[model samples]
Target chain A: MSGRSHAASRLVVAAPYLWLLLFFLAPFAIVLRMALSDADTALPPYAPHFEGFATLREFLGKLDLENFRLLADDALYWDSYLQSLRLAGLTTLIALAIGYPLAYAMAAAPRHWRPVLLVLVVLPFWTSFLIRVYAWIGILRPDGLLDIVLGGLGLTDEPLRLLNTEAAVLIGMVYSYLPFMVLPLYAMLEKLDRSLLEAAADLGATPVTAFLTVTLPLSLPGILAGAALVFIPSVGEFVIPDLLGGPDTVMIGKVLWNEFFSNRDWPLASAVAIVLLVVLVLPLALLQRARQGREAQP
Target chain B: MRKASPGSLRRAFQPWNDPAAKPLIEFRHVTKRFGGVTAVAEVSLSLYPREFFALLGPSGCGKTTLMRMLAGFETPDAGQILLGGTDITEMPPHLRPVNMMFQSYALFPHLSVADNIAYGLKRERLPRAEIAQRVAEMLALVKLDGLGKRRPDQLSGGQRQRVALARALAKRPKLLLLDEPMAALDRKLREATQFELMDLQSELGTTFMVVTHDQDEAMTMADRMAVMDHGRLVQIGPPDVIYEAPVNAYVASFVGDINVLEGHVVAVEGDLVRVETGITGMVELDEEAPALAIGASVLVGLRPEKLDLSHDEPPQPFNKVAGEIWDIGYLGDVTMVQVMVGGEGGWLVKVALTNRRRRAARPFAWEDKVWLSWDVEAGLVLKP
Candidate 1:
């Protein structure tokens, strides 16, 4: 407000600035150094290979029209990328349809009941990640609970093939990422002005129309955030596919995995990781910055 | 259930003398109760076409409840509500031929001013052209022309209030209800907007039912007012009638500034009932109330301006009291003089002394022995 107060606030901010430099900026610098250095057989924080940039260019160059040249055709990279995008997009959409109503119920329940709802949503998160995938595996297998139940009901004559399918992967993806989608959506929807709904009804919108025109539009931010949360995680998801997916249903995460662990091409895997990082993390970073922009508003 | 009262039907047959006499909306013996608590009890009142009516009461007195019921936001637990001689109590709020400007002015922050006003018209299924024209006209009426693209949050408080008013009026419903319309504004803005509301109501010729806790707001805005206490309607009349002729001590105390002196009834003779008090002489009721025998406790209320203060004792036969000036308060427009009558609690007496006539030395200083005096018509006796 005044010149002296401004100076005093600057002096106060200087302390946090020093802390951030020591804790956050230093760690980021370390990551930058590692990302730039070439991989070595020795310990990490390896020698500063100045040619790492040239190496990156060469590695990227090998991705063009030659030995691993199936990437140039429509069948290889496009098919995998398209398949990944479709799965991610559909998974996120399905998650929303299921998650929104669940989130709404969680938010609208009495304040005392919220913690119980939160715990129920988070119970899936508590189990070991691989065990959860294995649980889905147990259900989706041909002679497992799902086929057994269906066979008992006489819906299918025998144990219908259920495992290693796209549907199984989709089901697992939706189930696993649902809580991430719900939390932020619940946070946004819960804080919504109840008056707006009443106002809409008073202005002659039916309950259904009011939800579509008012409730849906105001919850856009939450929807977008949840979609990103589900999409980003699902794009790189390897566990669900590796466990329950069929032979033909390949995704980019499997590709990255095969290159790194199975094929033992660390440089190629790192390149794939970098590509996914650019595609997904860049937007996430921008969205986070936008959120900070809103927080900065007076 | 659809039967109109005998008196109401009889009055409905008479040729209306005033331009504002046609009944637009009527609450017929309506009572709303939430669980064990009655929010409004047997409230039968009518809002004539183009009349600015006010429901004034303290907090939790159900003035807002009555307004909400009229808007069809709250349903009466008993009795019927009528609009244009049609029983519309069962109608939903959206279907009713009325709109309400909420106390918070509930303007949609997401929508532009024009869109907010256009909402009801669009709901009514009017063509896009007609909706646009009406929105433009309504915006202009509220003096917010050429500002259609701006959202509600971008507007100032007064501007938002005007936008809300415009949005409510855009529907051109048979009646418009305002809930504490000026409560959100600053003092100066509130006073200014009160006149604007009055002028707008007159111009539009639409019946307005305003609910407020502030007495002065009701008095300044409404042609007629109903004073309520604890969900019970105390008195309903023109502003002046309700102010000058309150039915009880509560109404008298609540409607305006007054000094209510308690006394015992000495006699009753037709129109007048005389009561003797400790401070003043025999005091008379405003008009004839239900008769009570001798020695019934009563209160006589007097306005501050009516009570004349002097250093010398006035030779008044009745309604006279001796008081010492305990405190003097200087306001630019008027001064409040606190007088200690006997040994007990001192009474506040507002005196309208001219600034031009007062000398350098104050005429009435604290601790001065003075005599307070008034005529017979200066005060009323509250019985209830």
Candidate 2:
């Protein structure tokens, strides 16, 4: 019985690992191989397709870092990377600024009303994401709903030119990723021991001081998790920027798309994708390591 | 175990007896209600400086509510709370010069022990060297000297309790309120911590008001205690007085184990009263009798430890009854035997006998016919 149960547990553990190997690792290996090869005019658009094990050594020898080197040498790729990082960082900060108070209010609401608030946070997910992004266009375009409302309210004399701007892109991203930020924060703040706040007050810290010293520090794990959820996705976001941002708003995702489809530079696009993964994964891995080290302390 | 004799210390510092002594904290006609239920209703109390006071009651007895009002967590609806002659009824909790050791300890999980202790001091914006010195002193005071760098989760429960105590005390408030301070500790640790807390309170000379449900804990640590029931202060006195002379039936049973016998006053002789009980026949109490006509209904309260049990008939004639042993409970320190007197459908009276000798043979068994007796001073004549 024990041996059978052990085998069953092992199978349960292996399922996710197996899934990752087949779906993620296999595709990543193919991309890495394509990234190392040379661009060509052939149907596949990349040279040195795997010919068999007999020429394996030759295939390995043909692989090079030329695409990566070209990416580093060009200013457009560098600028796109920096702009992507900047936008993603700004999105995270704005989302946090909006999400923290929203989550805190929900957590402090009456117990029976909490479920309704949580449902409201997650309600937007029921709608199609693409449809929501399209809806933003109608609201943000000049002479659209926003401008009409502002003009009708006597707040503005002329139509607002907000569509296809970086501001529109920011508004779209913050609206889409808000739930991702709020849920974790709400979960953290809701379960916080209220006695700790009382203890703080008992110890002579005002409510604001208590929030800064006790609540904020304790909610850090939730903050980090929420930031990662918003940052990692917004860094490579293709839809919001493509739909709402102006031509001057150059992000790496748009650049990667242009390189792969318009220019048909398969190796360069693969290299760009690889470099983006490394940039995002490195910090995340470092953060996980630091968290684990702190948890392991006596 | 060296017992800290708070009894002697309390006798030497009985400020409540002195008419001229001013109370450090006072609550006057404080009334708090939640929705339809009155959690604390028209309650008034006082605590003198350096007095280790306890509010003892069962859950929902308003003991915690009273403490919370003093700690500035709850505002009284219609009353005044004065601290050192200043009315602080509407003062915010942070502005109040009172701190609380929470029932859950409420230690900050993210902070090191030293930082947790220094939190209130930092709020005062003390000098850096003074903060460190005070933190070190608190650490030593709680006997957590070398564990200052450890996080709260890393410490044991007892250690966490000490950290809470230290953190609350670091502010040196005029009054430190403890809400079931030792409720989280194990029984063994709880007993030891009670004495330690008493010692610490005396050494620091800070007035402490603890709220708890455990009678033993309150009796062991409190210089004086108040028993609360259903949002009202039922009785207030030292532990001995509360135990020996409870004003009513609820206070008597709530404080300790007492076998109540239904009886009536048969005669009143100057300072002595003779009562006739169904269970123990005629009993005489050698105490000042309350105003009573002959045959007025009364309750005779007999503490278990005050009664003696034996196989043979007791030498005394009055206040003795013959009964069959209904049950025997052998606790390590004492043997509690329930004697069913007055034959069938009669009252079962508990008699506690201390085991002074190791491995003493069982003197009483179940179904054994035994005689129970007590001195005249042992029976309390309580009005029914």
Candidate 3:
């Protein structure tokens, strides 16, 4: 019985690891192999395909650094990388600015009302993500709902030129990723012991002072988690910018998509994806390390 | 209002007795209501300087609400609260000269022990050097000197409790509120921390107001305690007086284990009253009941330990009841014998006998008939 139970437990532990290995790790290894190969006009779009052990050795031997060098030589790749980082950072900040207050309100609401608020937050997610992004197009386009409303209210004399702009992309991203930020933040803020605030006030700290010293510092973990949830996905976002943004909004994800489908440079696209992964992984690994260090201390 | 009470003479720190001694904190006709429930209703009380006062009650008895009002966490719907004779009714919590050691400790998880203690001092915007100095002093005071650099998670429950105490006290507020200070500690540690808290309170001379439901803790540490029930103060006195001379049946029953026998007053002569009970027959009680008339219904309250249990019958008639032993509970230090007397609906009196000897002189067994008796002074005549 013990042996059977031990095997069952081991299987439960191995399930997620096995799934990641089969799907994520295997795909990444294929991408790495494709990134090292030279571009071709043939089917599969890359040279020296792996057929067997000997052919694999030959493919590995013939791998070139030309694709990576080409990426470095092109200024567009660098600009796209920088733009992606900047936009992702801005989206994270915007989400945090809006989500913190919303989460705080939800947490502070009466206990019975919290579930309704949480449902409202997650209600938008029931619809398809693509459909939501598409809905933003109609709302943000020139002479769209915003323009009509503003004109009807006499707030604007002329039609607002809001369509296909960086602002539109930002609106879409923040809207799409808000629940990601709010859920984690709400979870943290809700679990916070209210007596701590009372203790702070009793210690002669004003409300604002208490928030700065106690609430903000204690909610750091939630803030970091929320930021990561928005930041990581926004960095690699393709659908929102593709639908809402103009030509000037050249994000790395857009660049990768164009390279694979329009430019047909499969090796170059793989190289860009590898570099993007490295860029995103570095900060995330650092965050995990810092969290571990904090846990280790106490 | 001051009275020359005899219990005040036993304590040197009886500021309430001195007519000139002003109270450090006062609640005048304070009333707070939560929705349909009145948590605290028109409560007026005073706490003298350097006194360790405890608000003792069961859960939802408004003891906590009273303490919260004093801490400025809850505003009273009516009446006023005064600190050092100044009206602070409208003042916010941060402006109040008070600090509270939370029941959960509420130690800032991100801060080290020293930093947690320095939190209030920093709010005062004291010099950097002065803040450090005070932090060190507080750490030393709580005997957490070297552990200042360690975060709250690194400390044990007892240690965390001390850190909370040190942090609350570091600001040197005139009044400190401790909400069930020892509720989180284990049985052995709780007793030790109680004495430690008492010593610390005396050493600093800071007036501390503690809220607790534990009768033993309140009795052990408080200079004086107020018993509360249904959002009203039932009795206010020293532990000795509250235990021995509780004003009503609620205060008497709530404080300790007491055997209340239903009876009616048969005769009354000055301080002496004779009560006729079904189980114990006619029992003489010494109680000052001026309004009690002949044939007035009353309850005769007797502590379990006060009853003397014996196998042999007495020479003369007394306040005694003979019954067959129904149950025996050996609690190492004492043996609790529950005796069932009379027929149906009989009185089941619990008689606690100390196991002081190595061998029992007369060991009691189940179903054995035993006589339980007490002196006339031991029985308290309480108004039913």
DockQ winner among the candidates?
Answer: 2
DockQ of each: 0.41, 0.81, 0.79
Ranked by TM-score from best down, the candidates are 2, 3, 1
Candidate 2 residues lying further than 4 Å off, grouped into runs, are B3-11, B315-317
The per-prediction i-RMS, to one decimal, reads: 2.9, 0.8, 1.2
Candidate 3 segments whose C-alpha is farther than 4 A from its true place: B1-11, B360-362
For candidate 1, the share of real interface contacts preserved is: 0.38
lDDT of 1 by residue, B1-384 (tens): 233323221122221246556577878889999989999999887778767789999999989888888877789999889999999898887777788888888887667899999987888899999999999999889899988988888789999999989988888877888988999999998987887787777677788899998999999878788999888888888888888888889998898888888788898888667889866667765455677778988888887767788999888667667778888888856678888887457555555554555555678888888888877677787875
lDDT of 1 at A8: 94
Decreasing lDDT order of the candidates: 2, 3, 1
Q: Which stretches of candidate 1 lie over 4 Å from their true place?
A: A1-75, A110-115, A147-157, A281-298, B1-22, B279-281, B284-286, B344-361
**Model 2, span B7-85: residue lDDT tens:** 3354566788899999999899999999899999899988999999999999999999898988888999899999999
Superposed Cα deviation of residue A94, candidate 1 (Å): 0.8
* Ordered list by DockQ, greatest first: 2, 3, 1
DockQ winner, 1 or 2: 2
Predict model 3's lDDT versus the native.
0.90
Q: Which candidate is the best by TM-score?
A: 2
TM-score of chain B of each: 0.90, 0.96, 0.95
